[model samples]
Target: MSAGAPPVVTEIARPWWDALARGEVAVQSCSSCAGWVFYPRPFCPSCGGRDLAWRTVDPAATLYTWTVAEAPVSPHFAHLHRPVLAVAELGIGVRVPTTLVHADPDDVRIGMALTPVFDAGTYPGFTLLRYRPA
Candidate 1:
């Protein structure tokens, strides 16, 4: 995401990221199609609706799928303090993704219910959304 000539946000999304400092997570919900959209775009993907708004989610989800990080790409990743889990799935029928934390490899599996967790430690230069086995 850093190969761009410049960052996508300057004045558009600083408020969204800054909201994490106060403890909240949101996704753009299209008032037209009633679909949830991520990456916080200004329009809806399914219906191409211009009427979109930020909606707070329950921070609870499920481990639809995941993988283990056995290889390291950067020092930042090496010292992550523990192995990582990436999960995705049909929440409200929208495929939401977030890192999985606080669960053992054996304890986690696809279809397991998970919940959103704010990992200040996993803050990737900004606050990040993570999940734990719900």
Candidate 2:
């Protein structure tokens, strides 16, 4: 495989890759309410506090919901459609909508458990977190 150009990583998420490079989950945790947040942010979602800090969360999460995309929404994704799909609800309380890999589309269901599988994309050369049935 040929190496390709890297994708443009946003400034807000660059720290996430730095943490992943160390094999650690750099999720934001609330200092006021102690609620763990997935998408790294500067404030607490539960308490609206600005004293949030990076903390490690269990890579484990339950599948709260899911959806099968069935249709090609993007030109780049059209060729990858072997029953291409999207899954939702990751982590304990965090909800993330993303692509599902290594699983059959017919096998997807709501409220199924899932875990994280990290990948450094071939063309984009960036970290991707894929969910798996747990």
Candidate 3:
């Protein structure tokens, strides 16, 4: 993949991507069940409700797990050396697969506080939501 390779933005996920472009983060939530959702979909996972809404969420999160990529997983990531890939549990209990920016792999710890960092340039057509030590 090239650096310009973009995510396949479906109609359901457009709002979330748009929010990321505006320096905000949001998740899908069921209007009926009040259940939070990620990787946007048309129906609620908890109640199978169709009344879902996009809601802005706090950028705060905690590192759940991470790994250092000394070798690129794909050609798109070949430009980066030793990038840290991480999963962070958001305040509302969603686990996000994100890159850890401005951090040393050696210093990262499970349960470390994190804050969001949106990158609109590196990926060309899409904005990437990443995290860094808070």
Candidate 4:
């Protein structure tokens, strides 16, 4: 869960954080195996390839699953009474853990189309991704 802010950026995940700051989402791809990688790493998990490339992907996904939290999962989220936590599957088959926004929690459905909402100022110097019904 790295971010643009200090103490959140890691050497292997800097590109991802930087891309999010620019309102984009970037994923790593293996040059040797042509496999997609998420959660940023130094080597390809598919084929142990050291040659990894960062590619910006379409900020669109489908709801893979979700839940409405009865209480804040963390103190940082205390302001939100009930948070719609969700895992959205991107077109490339990567599932991202994000918050479902701008919709009613009861209305969320599996396989529902979603789009990214980048919250640049929620955390100082960090950009976060959320999903909303598309």
Query: Best candidate, lDDT-wise?
Result: 3
lDDT of 1 by residue, 1-134 (tens): 12112224555466556655456766678899898877677778899998988766666676777877777545556654445567556356556656677878777788888776765554344666677888
lDDT of 4 by residue, 24-122 (tens): 999999999999998799998889999999999987999999999898776666677688999999999998899888979878899999989988767
Between candidates 2 and 3, the lDDT winner: 3
> In candidate 2, how many Å is residue 48 off?
2.7
Q: Per-residue lDDT for 33-117 in model 3, tens only? A: 8999887999998989999989999979999999999889998778888999999999999999999999999999999999888
- TM-score of each candidate? 0.75, 0.76, 0.93, 0.91
Whole-model lDDT per candidate: 0.66, 0.63, 0.90, 0.86
Per-residue lDDT of 1-134 in model 2, one digit per residue for the tens?
A: 23334546677667777665565556777788888766767677777888877766566556666566567566555555563344446455666555566767678677776767665654544665667776
- Sequence-dependent TM-score of model 4: 0.91
RMSD of every prediction: 4.6, 3.1, 1.8, 3.3
Report how far off residue 62 is in candidate 1 (Å): 0.5
Q: Global lDDT for candidate 1?
A: 0.66
Give the higher-lDDT candidate: 1 or 3: 3
User: What lDDT does model 4 reach?
Assistant: 0.86
Global fold similarity of model 2 (TM-score): 0.76
Candidate 4 or 1, higher lDDT: 4
Residue 72 in candidate 1, Cα distance off native in Å:
1.1
Backbone clash total for model 2 is 0
